[model samples]
Target: MGSSHQTVIVTFNQPGASFGQDAVAALEDRLVGAIEAAQAGEFDGNLIDCGEVRLFAFGPDASDLFAAMEPHLRAFPARPAHATLRIGNTEQRVEL
Candidate 1:
């Protein structure tokens, strides 16, 4: 959290990932970039916390937040190139 914000949690929803060094690294990089971009200059003291990134494509994890966020996530500059992001009008299908 910074000046006006409270907290920032980074999430990389790997529906059912085949955990591996390369896979983890890719997710890490993508998540970190998303967090950085979300800052939007509003907060400089962003804190990292541990949590799970529920897959936002379908099923129970999806919500208003996911619905609204997919589009924005697609716009993120460092989005994982090996992930299938059904974000907004852009459908970026990447494989790891």
Candidate 2:
């Protein structure tokens, strides 16, 4: 079942800045709950920090998962962020 799950990667472009750990953790919790409530997907609990922050989630459908997380992503204090929704072999980038 997990092998067939699709993925959504949301990258927050913070450049030289990043959100506080507490803030990010809170957002992750809220987003995960929202996604589960919507039956969109399961968060992989992966947070990558490079120059930006990347959040990952996986499910049977990427579009559905993206839809579930879009609002929260938009509500994030970060100004510039984007999500890469991968369904099957195709990927679509959305600015949030």
Number of the top TM-score candidate: 2
Query: TM-scores across all candidates?
Result: 0.27, 0.89
- The runs of at least 3 residues in candidate 1 whose Cα sits more than 4 Å from the true structure, single-residue gaps closed, are 1-17, 40-96
Clashes of each: 0, 0
Model 1 lDDT, residue 14, Cα: 38
**RMSD of every prediction:** 11.4, 1.6
lDDT per residue (tens digit) for residues 1-96 in model 1: 123322222244333343344544454455445444543222122222232232322221222223333444555333232333333334444432
The candidate that wins on lDDT is 2
Error at 22, model 1, angstroms: 1.4
Give stretches of model 2 more than 4 Å off: 1-3
Instruction: Please give, for residues 1-96, the per-residue lDDT of candidate 2 as tens digits.
Output: 466899999988776666777777888998899898999879887565765778999998898998888889999987588999988878999988
- Against the correct fold, how does model 2 do in TM-score? 0.89
